[model samples]
Target: MMGDTGRRRRSGPRQAAWEFFGAELKNRREEADLTQAELGMRVFVSGGYIGQFEQAIRKPQLDVAQRLDHILQTDGFFERMWRKLIKDSPYADYFAAAAELEALATQICEFAPTVVPGLLQTAPYARAVTIATNPLAADEYVEEKVAARLERAHILKDATRPVYWAILHEGVLRLPVGGRATMAEQLDHIAALMRTRTVLVQVLPNEEGAHAALGGMMTLMEFEDAPPTAYAEALLSGNLLDDPALVKRVQATYDLIRAAALSPEASLALVESAAEDYRRCASTT
Candidate 1:
């Protein structure tokens, strides 16, 4: 019972697992009296790669894991842990950086042109969107994804949470998903969240033609420790940019877009009106 309580006192499962792996790696390397660069040389991996793994920021592949285990004299410890971590996160590479950034973000500003950002999406809406993306996503998979997305939303309610400013294109509200009932519910959810003061939602009307961010959806996250980063994603691939120059360019573009969008007060009114229209439509059918 005492040990169980001690384990419970440790951080959450994901954080705990990462810390455990990191501690083991650090301890083994130190006991071997090897610097990170020295270990990298022996393993034929980059020093940066070694540092990332030790910090648990990146998971290693099988070959890399085996090499680390052999070099650290841990005898397959790295391999087992790597496998477990991968099993726990299927889309790790795709979303891991974003998740880590979200967890520590002090401010998050987003511009979504076509669809509602994932953090603001309702469960039914998220599920419908995910299902439509992949015909092979079974009902259970869709449910799991929806659950994950909703769990991510908890960051907004966190006590010491970040300031979230989201600029959504009017098209998102106009496109009905899961039928009128679901759309109404989703709009109502957004309005309710806005009222809570945790979220600031601005709508970029279609009339604001040819905006600066005609590229795609972008989220700029500012952190307490590292430099700010900008995330841009399409259907197949995503990029995380930390270069100060590039980030400044994106930030300037986002500022312009924000300026062109409706004010928060007006945006909320528009969203509420849309919800009402959807409610009336639902009632008629």
Candidate 2:
């Protein structure tokens, strides 16, 4: 686990490159049917070090990548890819950190009031929301952000990863993004995710009224080796709070809000009903 200062310092193209390289290395080793210990022997690194690199828990030096490429007989494949993969992605630095943390988290809980959380948004909804807020962003930039957000969903289905829980405001389901059809599809997607045992989806209805988190959306991420962190983002900026007191305060607020929300079963019914309403509206049009 990265220290708060280490996390702040390690956000950028360099980290992205390392994450990419780590994933690639893991894939290659598995394809070659080599254990971590065997791979470590070939690469001249310890098995524990190899495990850390694969988990993106540690960044490998350039020399390490070169050594691994030669020993693995990949002919500098990883080294060459590392140079090309470091180009800046459209996501903000904080978002990149959040993405990495989200991937590795043991559990995640989110409270969203305005819009659907990124992990649950459909492509069209995500694109429309991004373009509306970031009007100046290039088409490619919007696409990249949408793609990154959607990629986080993979963790939910990954058997080895942690469970995910999200609580969204009723208004999010009511908001008609990209038209009724798109909104219906988004609701359908959320409903589908709810069916997974590892995911819990709840909704705080408008009738619930004035809950503790009237402020804004926040995500609490708990990891195995590190203390929990709370992340909040706005139009152009984001803050990651690791101070124990602040995290606890935000977490307490989230707990209160979750208590006010409909139970998971009730939330599923609400989402399904809303989707039905959207479908009806779409049919009429």
TM-score of each: 0.78, 0.70
TM-score of candidate 1 versus the correct structure, residues matched by position: 0.78
Alpha-carbon lDDT, every model: 0.79, 0.78
Residues 1-285 of candidate 1 have per-residue lDDT tens digits of 112322332247776787688778878989999998999788876666577667654444567779988987887989898777756862445565566556656789999888788889999888778888876978888888888888788878766667999998888898997888889999999999998988999999989868834668899998553467788877756777765788999898899999899999999999999999999999999
The sequence of per-residue lDDT tens digits that candidate 2 reaches over residues 91-190 is: 6654655666666577899988888988888899999898988889999889988897787676666556566889999998898988899899999999
Model 1, residue pairs in steric clash = none
Off by over 4 Å in 2: 1-87
Error of 2 at 95 (Å): 2.2
Q: Mind sharing the TM-score for model 2?
A: 0.70
Which stretches of candidate 1 lie above 4 Å from their native place? 1-10, 24-87, 90-93
